[model samples]
Target: MKRTLVFGDIHGGLKALIQLLEKIDYSKNDRFIFLGDYVDGWSESKQLIDFLIELSQKQECIFIKGNHDAWCQEWLENDVVNDIWFLHGGKSTIESYKGIDSSHKEKHLEFFNEMKDYFVDENNNLFIHAGFSSMHGPEKEHYKTNYSWDRTLWEMALTMDERIQKDSLLYPKRLLLFNEIYIGHTPTLHYNVEIPMQGCNVWNIDTGAGFYGKLSCIDIESKEFWQSDVLQTLYPNEKGRNK
Candidate 1:
């Protein structure tokens, strides 16, 4: 059966990604929507991006840009690394690129540059790396970076009174604008839930692979999901957020 799957933050956990695909029995018919931050945390950052570049050639994918992706793109294009980013996995990312061909790096840079900040499918489901600030919708967002940084959208949904009916005026305008909103920047594990989290119509899929949690993917239609082993187990030698 054809399935449209939404993936959460990779955080450079290439092994987890590969393992997740095998577990899902992924096939060409399976559609993938990756919420970014593909590089960082783990030791295979460059390799992970390279694999994704090749995968896109064989399958349908919607790549949403995350804040980490933005930082990686800049590093690729300008050879500059952000001090803050280095402390939070950027050092590992740069290390992964060592000895990689410059030409190969360029292709990865192009892939990052072309990623979308947000995607709306035929069903009007919204796929974004983070959240948007505009109540009018992402199209009218005051700041595009908010697509990969805003937490207000998810926060509103998370804190909404469960008692409020969807039709009630008390409902948030933003939540009413889309059939559903999917995001990844904030890991669901933050709340101590290790699975995909639902807050109203918003879904948080980042299960925290960047740290000790597992990488996750959810079937947008059926809500069935899959996860990799805790990243620490997959890369015992690496400090995938043990720091």
Candidate 2:
């Protein structure tokens, strides 16, 4: 049977990602939904994008845009580099492109530009890089940046009382808009866990590849998941985002 796989924030851990795919025994029949932040963490950001481009040619892929991706996209498009992006792992991303020329950068830039802020499957399963704030839904989100930057939605889910049933008036209206929501951006490490986390109807798959955690993926239907070696071990000499 074909699989619908959802991957969390990669943060440039190319080796971890490769290990994860091999562990899962990836096939062309698998449908991949990658929650972005593909760049700005480790040394292989450029190579990671190259691999994704090639993979897309052979398999179905849906790439969601994350805040880091948005920042990298701007740099690629206009040569802009701000301090926040720099301190947060953008420097490694820039260094990764040392020998690359304009043509290659342009292709990668196009890849980043084509990424979607969010994707919704027929089952009303929402896939996005981050949370949406609007009570109506992501499509109706007024601050479009919320698609890649919002955290309040996840925060609300975390605070939800399990005893408070979904049908209750106290239930969050935003969570009701979708059957299930899958996202990345806020690392689970912040919550002191190195595994995928579920809060209400939302699943946070970003297991913190940008820091001490590992890269992760989930078989959305089965809820079975896989993870790579901790990124810090994979790139032992590098500090990653922990710096």
Candidate 3:
């Protein structure tokens, strides 16, 4: 079986990320999937992005845009969007690239632009940065933007049951369509736990790494998780404060 190493929501923890990679013993044959949010909450956003870019050049890596990444992309597109992006952890992202040249900013933007919204393997394992919409049929097939900010769809899926709810409006038919959906953005109580919901079809891997949470990774086939040690005081107390 192919081994895929999946991680996301780094929130700028360069040290923790390095440690985690060492534990994995990453190799040329393995594939890495990063679910986005490479910046924010911690201080190493720029470093992490740079490392990821370098890693992508040598090995297989798939990057998806997170909400934070979208903010950065918007800022890069126009200064008019700076205020909006800054409010959502773009401030830290800017700080991460302090003293860098315009070329660096362009590079980061290019990387973000190329990220995929979702990755589906031949086995039908779907990997998305955020959860999908709950609405069934055509809504599920809509482009990336629809899935990125659609919270209602995610809420419906999370609350839906596994048995006897087919085509029910209260629950989503889309959730039942995938072999497994691996997602970030919603943190789990424990970093090592996969937080299976809706009959183990959906796995939440965020582990709150940006908000007093640990960085986490999962072995997709085994459904086993690995995480950094807890660091309660790592994040700022101010609500939405950029670290």
Best by lDDT: 2
Question: Candidate 3, overall lDDT?
Answer: 0.69
Reference-based TM-score of each model:
0.98, 0.98, 0.82
Cα-based lDDT at residue 89, candidate 3: 62
lDDT of 3 by residue, 80-134 (tens): 4467667666677777778977898789879989988878888878888776653
Q: Give lDDT: candidate 1, residue 42.
A: 94
Enumerate residue pairs that collide in model 2.
none
RMSD of each: 0.9, 0.8, 3.7
- Give the per-residue lDDT digits (tens) of candidate 1, residues 122-159: 89999999999888999999888899999999999999
Model 2 lDDT on a 0 to 1 scale: 0.93
Q: Rate the local accuracy (lDDT) of all candidates.
A: 0.92, 0.93, 0.69
Off by over 4 Å in 3: 134-144, 162-171, 189-200, 231-243
Judging by TM-score, tell me the better candidate of 1 and 3.
Answer: 1
Q: Give the TM-score of candidate 3.
A: 0.82
- The stretch of ten residues in a row with the least summed lDDT in candidate 3 is 234-243
